[model samples]
Target: MVKSFMTLAVLVLSAAGVYAQDIIQVQGTTPDLYVMHTVKKGETLYSLGRTFSLPIKDIAAENNISADKGLQLGQNIKIPLNGANFSQKADAASGGAPLYHKVEAAETLYRLSLNHNKVPLDNIRKWNNMSGDGLKKDTYVIIGYLKGGSGAVAHTPTPTPAPTPAPAPVNNTPAPAPVNNTPAPVSNNNPAPPIENNTPAPTPAPTPTPAPAETKPVASSGSSFESLYMQQTSNGKNATTEKGPGGWFKSNAAAGKYYALHNTAQRGTIIKVTNPLNGKYIYAKVLETIPQIKGNAGLIIKLSDSALEALGTNDPKFYCELSYEN
Candidate 1:
């Protein structure tokens, strides 16, 4: 009866549709809470815990695994919930504090916000007062929870102005003279011969020419294709098939071939597709909304033939747990 009750409770939690958090607990005497979460592809245990609320020590104790180790796909680990209350006021207020993080090359502020859910991108912007898009590599930003309540600052330091330079000394007196200025007599005594003055040349006659009119060529490049679009179809008075964000559209490509149409789905999503059989994973970009079609609860992803082959899938459609890459 106890086993049945426990199974029923787990089923209820699963059916409630609340996404499972990174936590797992042992069913034994004095068992501690563990950060239990399903291992997604490309996820390391250390990274998963760090991203969420679990500490490295807690994660190690819960899983009976070493924190210095890595994680395998589909592995279930325990996560303690002691400090897991994210929606609480204290958690939000204490979101930013003094924590050190090594800035990765090409990492941006927007990416950082996504990586650390509690740290608001706007707060980072206001704290740094960054004038441009985001942060660059090797730059430092506060990583831990923040202290003090939000309000006006008590005082702000003003920068000191630079001092003026002293003026250079001027000359007191003017100096000395020239050696000599000699003048010679003119030799115009042999200029008795008369000189001939040539007549001035006539101005060239004006040439007549027709004025050219400006010409504007018609545009050859087509308009931008919709990044997210929908389509429907019917056949012989009955709906047989429908697909879009899938057809071909004339594009401005230099090859003169029509562009392969895709729904764009806002922007292409970076997804990690895993093959459960061998524990292999391939990263792919889901560029269409076909998976989001009505009546399809499962994530149905379509890929180019080459991309599909690379991922080792021969089917027309496949399912995957998608994690967007910033």
Candidate 2:
């Protein structure tokens, strides 16, 4: 079986690597900001990096997979093409040991070690404490962690946002309750300043269906998305504005230098972050979304360790400010 798997891998990689190279399926899976690649039968992380022109460690870090645990067949893992350029030095910051991979079906001690750039199976057994060939799924295995942190993130084609549905056609024939033509005497209390209506004044009946406004990216604050988002969440004064109350962030993979985790910025959007305490700032592209989990509301945004250090420190929960120009 091992011999067959190896042969299959080389053959498929040799053939498919040329034609389907770098074709990552776009998955708008929550939180992540890159294309998703489904694990295939004859593939390993190393081969995947080769096909996509990325480093294996970057792929491991992106999904936070420990080398030993191994990928499951058909598992959907994020491909951080944008995360490739990051330095791997931050792996030291995560810990001394390499991140472990959780085992999945059809994975063996031999296959697992082979997938890890051919680390010896005996060493794998020694590291994880083993006595025999038997192995279990859903367990973590170490494949050796990396030393650098700033890995390269090559840009790939971005998928277009899903098309918005057309608005229902407005009926022009029925005029709005035919406002009385007769002039009325002016009232003393000039009708309280238009009552704060946000509705776009019913799109005058003249042009029955106005073309939808073209969407352009904008630095958001005061946009309705922000207004609605801010209404539900609590924050320090001005926290919701570009200036922030950010903290040190967590990433599955080692995020490249100057990358950040924001709850609202669209993936690939670049924003500037500042360490208010020291007045140091750097621009980072938005790489992933910080989920709004109800239990963890201490910080508004999180910066990668490299980003945190770039801003000058690695305080686990440090706070900072941010600015965006779309």
Candidate 3:
């Protein structure tokens, strides 16, 4: 009777979609409250983070796998069954929230505020720790936060439309009425001199073709982005559960030694992307933030074919995790 009752209970649980986390118990005892996941052939840490609704960095830290050391197939990783707690390092204030901004080319305090809804230049300097009115190429400057609301930023530079090529002009300028300059063929053919065979005809050696140039892979800064980003955002980060970076899209528009297209990262920023299935990683420069496209949900970033090849593979698409210096 008891066996039958237990079987019935398990069936009910299964029907209710109650999946227990598979954890490795120490000596038949559960020490840490985390799940141990055996990596699958094509599963990536990015997907795992999305599955658990946790940040990729948190998952990486819990498993002792640095963001640089990508996940590998058949390897077991831990997923912390706890909430993520992130806070800003030096930009938290009591009165208002904080905004994040990346300095572009020739951006100044006045221009930044104007671009960001005219949020006052003095406020921008105070929040971002800026003393002089100078801005660098790719550095982040915290804009003043809004009060009584989440610190979500809103700014979109209008995409420049591509120039349309003009149609070739039709040369209707009347082809100068064809001049009747027909050179007549000579009818008389003088008997050509009898061709003589070369005295010594030796087969010349085949010309050797020059070898193709060897391409050196770009020096990836995967380790640097991983370590630095992790440490910088470790303490006090926004703990909201947003969609994380997933499969890398292939593109050749911004092709380079190490270039990629991201949806949200600032241009010229360095980012670390790990192909979790093979434990391979590469650091790529954000060539541009791709504008949103229809039906592109869950798409994290796009990488150049050459950059993806440097990471490991040249497949059409593959899953990867992203880490950047925020």
Candidate 4:
């Protein structure tokens, strides 16, 4: 009886360890840096709030659900990671479970750092035991941990499943015979007479006309986010405007998908960014707040590198005007 009890206890502990390891599966990140979470059985808004260190009401408003409504199992939700709740400081490890960002296609280490509130690039390397800047798609990279969550960060890299080999195509079409374009060789035994042709001096072939130079199309200053901006402010409920110095960061987002990091605008809010120097403008979506780094001090906004180029500026910092719906 004693041996059976000991065996049962070991099995329960092993199961608990497995559960903890699988608890934090990252779905994806929002434009504003919020991580998506799928609701699990027994997870209430109140409990989620406690787990993520966010106010219950904030979570409810973010997902457009009533605070009193219970979360359904497998329902998707977003966990906000603003300055108020998220942290990347080395000391923050003591407070929460590590949060991870699943690397997407063409995502670079530099872009990853900028997306995650500009966490130090070295810190990211240290956390994942990465020896270089390269990252494979679908690899989970630790961005930071939740401030009040449980469990230690398991640094074990998620194994990427090997891709299945595609079947070789079978070709049934026969290949065409090679064309012989060489002229026939003359035989020395049969001396052929040379035929002289006077075809009117070949009409002095007209000088070939030079083709016109190709011109590259100029990139438009317009942004695809413009429609989103218009829709967001169609009601004009919380319109706000500001003009100040703006900074820029590298991004892998497609051209014209301009994005920004502002201190006050809510994530996903579209802001009209205009370069006062040249009157160039673009509508940029706010991702999150400008990271509290030394060089970022005093900047009103941070634009993606593509957004800055669309604005027709090479300057890393420039004066700009912004209009957005609160």
Clash totals for all candidate models: 22, 25, 6, 2
Candidate 4 — which residues are off by over 4 angstroms? 1-15, 23-31, 151-326
Q: How far is candidate 1 from the true structure (C-alpha RMSD, Å)?
A: 26.4
**Model 4 weakest 10-residue run by lDDT:** 161-170
Ranked candidates, highest TM-score first: 4, 2, 3, 1
lDDT of candidate 4 over 18-67, digit per residue (tens): 55655343433434767677677678888878777788999999999999
| lDDT, residue 276, model 1 | 39
Q: Which stretch of 10 consecutive residues in model 1 shows the poorest summed lDDT?
A: 158-167
Evaluated at residue 135, the lDDT of candidate 1 is 48
Each candidate's TM vs. the true structure?
0.22, 0.28, 0.27, 0.43
RMSD of 4: 16.2
Estimate, for each residue in 1-326, the C-alpha lDDT of model 3 and write its tens digit.
Answer: 99999999999777444222121221111223344556765667776665554678888877777776667877877655432321122343453333345567876554454444444444565665555456776555655332332222111211221111111233554555553333333323433433323523433443333333332333354454345444544631611122344444433222233556676676665666767667666666665555466545666777756667767776555677777645
lDDT of 2 by residue, 1-326 (tens): 99999999999777654432322232322223345666776667776676555678878887899755667887876765333321123232243223345566755554454444445444555555555445566545544432333222122322321111111234554565555433343454557556746556765665744553532222222233233333333322323346546675433222233555677776555565667677666666555566477534766676655666667766667676665533
Tell me the deviation in Å of residue 214 in model 1. 29
Task: Locate the minimum summed-lDDT window of 10 residues in model 3.
Answer: 21-30
What's model 2's TM-score?
A: 0.28
Model 2 alpha-carbon drift over 4 Å, by segment: 1-241, 250-256
